[model samples]
Target chain A: MQVTKREFLVATAALALASGMRSAQAATAINYWHHFASQSEMAGLMKIIELFGKSHPGIGVTQESIPNSEYMAKVSSAVVAGGRPDTGMVVAERFADLTAMGALVDISERVKGWKGKANFPENRWTGMSQDGAIYAVPAYAFVDWMYYRKDYFEEAGLAGPPKTFDEFLIACRKLTNPAKGRYAFGMRGGAGAFKYVIDVMEAFGSPIVKDGQAAIDKAAAVEAITFYSNLFVKEKVVPPSAPNDSYRQIMEGFRTGQTAMVWHHTGSLIEISAALKAGEQFSTAPMPAGPKAHIARVAYAGNGIMKDDHVDAAWDWISFWGEKDAAIALLEATGYFPASTAALDDERIKSNPIYQAASQTLDFGRLPNRFVGAAGWSESVVNPSFQSVLTGQLTPEQAVDRMIEGLEAALR
Target chain B: MKSVLHRGPLAKLGDLSETRYWVYLLLFPSLILLLLVVAYPTLYGFVISVREMRLTRPGLNGWVGTKHYVAMLSDRVFWISLKNTAIWVTAAIALEVAMGFVAAVALNRNVPGTKLFGVLILLPYFLPNVVAGHMWALLLDPRLGVINDILVKVRILSSYKAWFADPATAMAATIVVEAWHGFPFFALLFLAGLKGIPEDLYKAAAVDGAGPIRQFRLITVPMLRTVITAAVILRVISLVNSPDLLLVLTGGGPGNATQVLSLYAFQTAYREFNFGYAGALAVVMFVILMVFATLYIRLTRVSKD
Candidate 1:
């Protein structure tokens, strides 16, 4: 049979298109939305993605990084507007809000069947679960700890880091020297200030939420607010900027020697290490004990399915983060503690004295408050209330009353 | 050579253009676009405001007429935000206009380096609000800010000041930063309006024995009235709607000292996940802007002119 050149070209194009479509169909592409904005966090995420690609050749993962502050905004919009990603990063504090909004899919069945689930303890899953249904696979942890300047401590004739709040106050007074333009603590009283405020309240034996209701011990909370605010208002140890010092300000304060100490999580270890020398210049310690009890948060950040359209592929990708290699890779790059029991035993984590504080915290650290309206109550109420105390707009008693009123409203 | 023409859809459209139906055809795309982009979202916002559309508490999703609005009546934050919004908008506008007028007149002088000065003046407007906020935050930082260092060296300050941390100073500091960023918008528009005014008018004023200030009052101000009205309205709308800079610098902090209506609305929607309440707040803002625009135009008599 005779064929025209045009017909031959058309047939060739058809064949190519068919082949491309087949190839595309064979690979299941899943989109992941996360808020890992830091350079090191991105590096760790890329490492995990690279490893996941190698392990699951048939599944393709694409990631979208949202700024941590705007993560919930973006996710909520996605949920309401109907363009949800297949999977997303879920922090302990935001899990309730995310689940309440129905942004995360129920992964309890998948989690139960997975072999890698054995690595995680029941407490690890507690943050990511609601009403006995797991929503995410635990990836890494942000174990709370204190970063203190060793040089400043030694200069002040302090033998070691403070173990209790009373000792911490003494050290704050000793380490602070206004003549040298140095402060004692980098109090994060600005955005995300709610975390420390809640912690302080809990440390003073105030229950934030009990049985999904506001259960704060008013006296304890009042006392907690007074003590925390005193570091800035009364003691004059924290910088004047403490009322507006968030993560960046606090980190800058500690790294530049403007302040003697800061309270942050293990996630900041890599960033701090980049600026200051470990052991000699600065060192890590578990957060100081409060009056009634010690409180440190081991906030487990994990990944959950946002949409179940590509359920199998999404499941595989999130589950991979629970494995030892991914956790270790993340820890190496970002200094985030591993949520998996197996990854905790890695030589890199075990050998580093810098990680000792985080290791100790793993034993006693409490998970962040996880209830509906918890985010709202903390951010809208606790943050501003605490700041009011620091700025002398409201006394500790008034602030506590305000917080109690706000919490009740939130629970209602 | 002879040219050959083909009759097709293009020819058909050309024929259709001559008909009365052509105007409707041209208007059709824009009509659909307006409905989709502007009308639909606005109506939806109104609907949401009257309903219980909390994303987290979906179980409570139902029509709850005037509930959010009623709640706003007694909301302490809402009242504080309202007062702050008035101060933020009014103070920022006054500063922006004064600075912008000075800048516009300076650039209009046609002096040497005016082009470079124009570009320099417009640089702040070119920056995103988020970037500008961060830059200003660092500049006013208590410890390492260059501004603080200079202030101390010049004896303007005994020590560094935490601008955003102090409730007394936070609102004022943010206003100054906003004015710096937004004045360029007025400068550009006013400069354009100045260029269009006849130089003969100024010459006549000068001949009539008007001094520089008198001539400016009589000629420049009168001529730029329309531009001034347009610029004020646009800037007010923009200032009222955006919450980015405040979100970056303060997140409405030091006990909601810097909180404005827009920022409060944003926190209500995103942080609290109370979209219904947010929608009500937005509706209030929308009404406020509408009333302000109407009153402003009436008071200035821009339409009469």
Candidate 2:
């Protein structure tokens, strides 16, 4: 059919006007990618999303959960291949790598102007910052603590959790009974074992990185490795599976009464609580101190804008995680400690006796090692080097040498 | 073909199919697709191997002639990984072929429960690599594994054994898991080959007073050589390239005891963000695989047949 020029122009103008009106009325849809795969974590995320929906009805948020192990892989792929989410979860360990790959946008300006920023102190921002520019809004904290079987501790005549590494070793001797399938500690030596390895080194007065270079104290690191590996290799207080036992195995060992104690963070409280009765079956304690120092990591996990396509909506969603209601909701559902001091003051957190260990850790806990190559070095070099020690393939001195060499290579 | 309309805009195109250029025109789409999907990525990978392409340190990315390859010459882990890869591939192939042959021969008899047995034999293959890895991990778990429980009950062991934790047993455990998951691939192919063999040949052998085993060796081996060669090549390529099973079960550790080339390359690329080194690793893998396939085919004399 033939059409006149004036008629076609009129129709095109009408369609454009309709399209403009519809777009003006549409809600800003922003996508969030996170690594919260646990049922409790998902519930907490959904709770915050619900609260967000109520508070900001004009902005719509969609969430995607990636497994923690594969999160960085997927994020890097997205950055290189070009299908980035509006916002993503950022952990302290991944901050440097993420920024180096340009996976996250600089949100320093938005953070400076955020009203809820006051709730987070300087330390909370230290992990998510590089060169005085913040990339994420601190949402919650992963406070390192220990979960011990209370009944077993009582049976072994231990009055309370050990206060130092020496006491911890003595407790290990008393608590272990292999004939009954009981071990003192559930050691994590698999995929994420590097975190504890680094922490132990620091507790023995070995700095990982200082002045933007490899600063590991070889002697102190060797001492730390010897002490830690001895629990499995020489002391035989840990299970035979310590070399390959990761988070799931360790948790199972603690809950099933195979292990008397396991080191983890407060994030796993709800999972353990679901499996065992608090105080009667299990209790929490701060990580025992080493001879040279007491080291416990208080890693602040937060959200950041990955792509600024929907910058305003993404900022709104991430910043809302720092609000009191959002933080409290997450804590109530998942037992993740709130980064916001205002949320930490909530009665639900303060009234719980189980959270006392986490509260104590907050007083003196240090941030994780945050160099550009931290993840690669920890996972690739530190994990294997320590595992070699556990399996008796390398002496403590050799392992320390390997770690020093690897750290130097990484920093270079 | 339609006649050309000289007065319209489509005049030249309407007569195109009538010319010699039509052949090139028909091949043009396929050639474009091949270049886009295959040639481009392959050339890109080769280019990446000779250059620095780290995702984390983008500033340092540039042309670096043979730096990664030179560094790999003295890399202990790379050498260890190469040795382990050889052992892994050889061991897994041996187990898979043995298991698959037995299954295929047993199924060819067509017994009363052959169909059910066939399905059961293929069940492990139906599971994805990730699922099968996790399943085996739980079944062999030191703390609460059913295998450990049974072994203890049967007095086969004094206590539970951590299969994947101990370096001595980690590689063997992963090999067993790989064999279980991959055996069915060979079984299916071999079963089809068995069906295609002439029944008259067996009859003739029986008439000539040859026993079952001798007849089978003489008839079956020669007849299935082509199928066996093809199956082994495909399975080897898959086993060499795919790292998901090992990634899930071991992550190439208990201190590099289970480390293989593919897993090493993957960790280098993703975890370290050192794509240049990973690309170099990939190039090495490609060369090794090409050499293996060529030598294997020649040694077997499958092409002469």
Q: Which candidate is the best by lDDT?
A: 1
lDDT of 2 by residue, A1-412 (tens): 9999999999999999999987775648888999999988999999999999999999889999998989998998899889999999999989999999999899998888889988888999999999899999999999999999999999988999998999999999999999999999999999899999989999999999998799999999999999999999999999999999899999999988899999999999999999999989999999999999999999999999998888999999999999999998999899999999999998888989999999999999999888888899999999999999999899999999989999898887
Give model 1's docking category: medium
Worst 10 residues of 2 chain B by lDDT: B1-10
Least accurate 10 contiguous residues by lDDT in model 1 chain A: A22-31
Interface Cα RMSD per model, in Å? 0.7, 0.6
- Report candidate 1's fraction of native contacts: 0.87
Q: Pairs clashing in candidate 1?
A: none
Ignoring the other chain, what TM-score does chain B have in each prediction? 0.94, 0.93
- Misplaced by over 4 Å in model 2 are A1-27, B1-24
Is model 2 an incorrect, acceptable, medium or high docking prediction?
high
What's model 1's lDDT at B5? 58
